[model samples]
Target: MPLLHKIAGVVVVCAVVLGLTLPAHRRGAEKESPAGRVGNSSSAAPAAKVSGSPAPSGSPTASATPLKPIPAAAPGAAAVKANELGQIPVLMYHRIVPKPEMSLDRSTKELYDELTRLAKGGYVPITAAEFVSGWINVPAGKHPVVLTFDDSTPGHFALDAAGRPKADTAVAIIQRVAAENPGFRPVATFYLNKELFGMADAQAAAGLRWLVQNGFELGNHTVTHPDLSGMSEDGVHKEIGGMEDRIVQLAGRHTTTFAYPFGAVPRKGKWARKDGSRYSFQGIFLAGWRPSVSPFADEFDRWNIDRVRSEGKIKENDCTKYCSTAWLEYLDKNPDERYTSDGDPNTVTFPKTAEDRLAKEYRRRARTY
Candidate 1:
């Protein structure tokens, strides 16, 4: 193969291999439970608060629904008035490695400590559906945070020297924290590609089944975890729709949520694909991929919501920084502020001059994978 072809081939092979092995090795729950079923919404609009009004009494409810709207405060009142339009931050993670050598991963101990801090600090870790549904209403003082893990890496469930699934370590951490903190039952969503779930590994399959059986929800990241913005419509369907099918098969539930691989969204370019199969400008808009500084638009696709990446070793203090209470507070006050632009996922109106530079950086980083 030519040098370029060789590199492309390698990329394709790696993607296939990683896709196939990870899910097979770390399978969890597949059965649907009340927790998994309650908050699942195919549409994102249902998740937003409606003009500071309580949802109709018959509207679907979740176990941890957001608090009902209180009367608007008097002008200049002492209370810090809650912004009814606040955007919920969906925090993302790739790995939780134990050693500095594995910087992307957080150690077992570190993961536990971080969860503990979140609980004590009053951060409610909710599933994507819950966040989207505006489910699990908490008081204005209690902010909602969505915890997500991407890639479905082996380390997420790898065995220690003693030969036990490493996921147990993370689960144990959550269990302990939940035990001590009664009201801090944090739920997490795991986005996995079909290739990640091994058809041959019974143990891994069981692990995934267990995840769904428990309170955790499974989300579709993509069948191959590719950058959809650059692919053909068929490619996008294979990546998005294919993964959704696989997740439903493996997890025994239909998955409506999606997380973009490398978080890339389509730009305002012409679509070369045939009509009827072309990308929907409206669908893209509903996907919530826009410049961060635009006025907040409530329309969104629960499947392709935005996320904030969490990195480095997971420490309790790091959680404070990663979760950024200040940032959450800012969003709380300025609910109308957008996080990404409709024209391009990478563009942001703030610090306006750097948009091109930032977009270039994003593209370069994405090309590596």
Candidate 2:
């Protein structure tokens, strides 16, 4: 057999093995629970955030073997902002390993550069919960950016004994950059499936707790990361609800955001939920080529929230179609269209033309920046 074919076969097998052996997380509430919260561990060493080991990579582009047709975008040659014309660029990532392993995977250096660029550009990370609530509340004069790491790969994050993000890991890189830049924030959302970062029960539980306790956010990415369009409502419920249950167990909190698996949804509609599940997400994510509009924007669609895949090197990833890197370039070339911070957290600001269309009732302190 050809060597390339053998390599592809190996990749497939590794994916399957990882999927089947991943420890379980979501079950009904009464099933069982871990021994204790993260702080209950025997170590008395105070949890002072420190640094950890070296590892990190980029988003998982492995599933979309072909550039599957993405959701229909807003009509126009120029990128249009959703509701009241407010746009927020959300960067999507997958496996953030120490070195790049695939087209979708990027190294720690790459992740660091991308994040630092945002920080330097006056961007601040915001939680999906905040986005859904229409309360951005990022520092005044800082544009809001959402960093989403899908798949929950082990390479994405790992901590040292001191509870710090170790070297080269995505979390560490993010924290390092945030610490170095006064206005940047160390916040992100992780969308997980059956495998929580390649860790077993206790380790997985700690990883989840570290995220919530440390000001990060978590979301449901379904149980096994299946194509939702093919499944019945019951199956979808099991997939989403089950994952939500597990995340609550591991993270000690419930998530109100979700990322569609394979970017597939049941009807290409606006929202979905498995009844009786502990979660009812207000923001549902779609695999992307651009950012989302403000939740309060007139065009905001809870059904198809958009996200841009991380990595600015568009040519290498067929970036024009594969991700949102082009928009970064576009923003560079067209600075005015970009979302610039107005130095106020109580109000939502955008181009003057959008003022008339603003949802007035939602604004307590409405004014131009």
Q: Per-residue alpha-carbon lDDT of model 1 for 189-278, expressed as tens digits?
A: 777765453334455466677776767767667767777678776667656666655555566676535566776754422231112422
Candidate 2 shows a clash count of 25
- Cα deviation of 362, candidate 2, in Å: 2.3
Cα lDDT over the full model 1: 0.48
- Candidate 2 at 349: error in angstroms? 3.1
lDDT of 2 by residue, 199-304 (tens): 7879889888988889988889988998998887777777888988898887788888899987887862322543554667777888867777666554566657
Instruction: Looking at model 2, report the run of 10 residues with the lowest lDDT sum.
Output: 37-46
Q: RMSDs, each prediction?
A: 21.3, 22.9
